[model samples]
Target: MGGLLLNCDIGESYGAWTMGLDAEVMPYIDCANIACGFHAGDPSVMRKTVALAVAHDVTIGAHPAYPDLVGFGRRSMVCSAQEIQDLLHYQIGALDGVCRAQGAKVSYVKPHGALYNDMMANPAQLRAVVEAIARYNPQMPLMLLAMRDNAAAQAIADEFGVTLWFEAFADRAYDALGRLVSRNLPGAVHHDPETIISQALTLSRGEALIASDGSELLLAAQTLCVHGDNASSIAAVQRIRQALGKTSAS
Candidate 1:
């Protein structure tokens, strides 16, 4: 086990499509992975999110995604590794520039949606993202989904001299292989408050969970992510934070 951090995917709102409870969820998280304009944010939205994170004294992170504004970056795309690296660099720079304006810099980078999934399952894409992170700022940590097979991923990150931050879903279900269950699946997300808190506590204690396939899933993580897009997501984060606080005190 390692130090625990609560993080959230935030600043997803676009021009007129408000997507998340950014203001309500900012205070409960340790880090904010703000959208970098390609997937879900605009210039004004990015600025607002940066200001909100600064106001809450939260660590700022870049949430870069594939250029799929229509599918909300959830749909996978086919591109070369060089292209992946370039787009990632572009998105990260966008957020980094925004944070610098507010005297808060990007401390880490987390690829959003399809890009994130692609990196987890595809070696070429993973290398591309890690390479981009290393080239842009070696000190900036790259966030990846926590899994039983992170040793291999860690090795690739180490090759680039990029720090790997394993992250887990606080309210989402996992498959037998420790990957997140597809969103289309039933019971893919746990909405019950107590269940979410219990899962968080179990992870803090270095325990594994039974996956959807009735197999053990190791979700070792340094950070737990709570999605803020859905309703009541803010309350869920609040409760989980309180539970984590008590664990820290004890």
Candidate 2:
């Protein structure tokens, strides 16, 4: 099997308001990063999402985020390492509880939104996340962004005896350092379906991407993240999955 697994951020619907085409994209994804009620999703949404993932046989991952329901967990907040760990445990446990009800467990963890970006940029924050997962369940892997040089992150994960699944974004732009460009920046996100699919294929093939700074950047990623927030994005994900199937077979 190919080393690359397809994952998507899903189960983000909050209360009566809904988000994402979770049902439409579940079949194509290998991992479902379900929102764990902190950023988005409530008990009902979490239960429904976990059931859907179980039905589709997709690996369930806890999508932990800062407690920012109003901000959708996209706004960064000042938090200490202990606080970060607390947040992770709270969110993961909530999702795991929902998953257990459906006879499934949270197989992994992928921090959501600002917390994810914060961990990538701050080693202390990353360590807190890793430590949280390790303390909860050492077997569960922690998914973080794939960088140009992943040695530091790997070292930290190794220290905690936690497995790391370096993830790449096919629909997002990267900087020279292999960090994702800010959404506020121009051309930070790839909008075209063809561009998104091509990027997915490139990363799957272990090829280099042209960074936003016009530099060659390569990311060693074990999973590729695709967004399912809209119809056009879902269409791109479908094409991406089909294209990746050929790459995997080859």
Candidate 3:
């Protein structure tokens, strides 16, 4: 196993409101998934975020969610394949415009919130997303959750000629099947820095962490996600980066 890329969801703030500490968190992440207005970002925020990411020499990715601003794109929307494809194109195009304006390029696409979860289990939704990405830029990679035993999503990505990066969460707990434990459940999130650091180490070492059911679920991931909403997340990322650096040096 080699060092894994660390990514974070950012630029989530809306007008007259603040969200994640983007500046503080940027130095620790390899990739920055900037929200494309659908979930929680506005035009001004998106531009500023892209510039900041460029300044920090981080890879920029598009984080597109459903067109549900009020629900923060966390509520499932009933959408047909065509509808999903259209939404994906619209959102990716929005981010591409911002990235172009900022003298940067959107290197990948990561569906945000509910749309992301829906695509995990629904082949139709996955195809829609893959098709949208292929239509926009066939070379761009698709970011997806790390699955324990299933290869459906990966298969879809392969069929579409799109590279896939399996993403593991730093703050979220996992079930035995390697799926994220429902947020509605207790102990779904780990906010403690030490705990997060330990989990990250396990992931980086290609070891399986104990899931909620006490079963070991292996995940070979290329990227790890640190939530921007957590206050201590920056510190946690720093700790994980330092740990990985030391391991690599040794």
- Distance from true position, residue 73, model 3, in Å? 1.0
Candidate with better TM-score, 1 vs 2: 2
- All candidates: CA RMSD (Å): 2.4, 2.2, 2.5
Ranking of candidates on lDDT, top first? 2, 1, 3
lDDT of each: 0.87, 0.91, 0.87
lDDT of 1 by residue, 120-144 (tens): 9998889999998999999999999
What would the TM-score be for candidate 2 when compared with the true structure?
A: 0.97
Mark the regions of model 2 whose C-alpha exceeds 4 Å error after superposition: 246-250
What is the Å distance of residue 160 in model 2 from its true position? Answer: 0.5
* Native-to-model Cα distance after best TM-score fit, residue 181 in candidate 1, in Å: 1.0
TM-score of each: 0.95, 0.97, 0.95
The sequence of per-residue lDDT tens digits that candidate 3 reaches over residues 93-171 is: 8888988987889999999999999998788999999999998998999999997965888788889899888889877
Per-residue lDDT of 118 in model 2:
94
Model 1 whole-model lDDT (C-alpha atoms) = 0.87
- Which whole-number lDDT from 0 to 100 does residue 2 have in model 2? 53
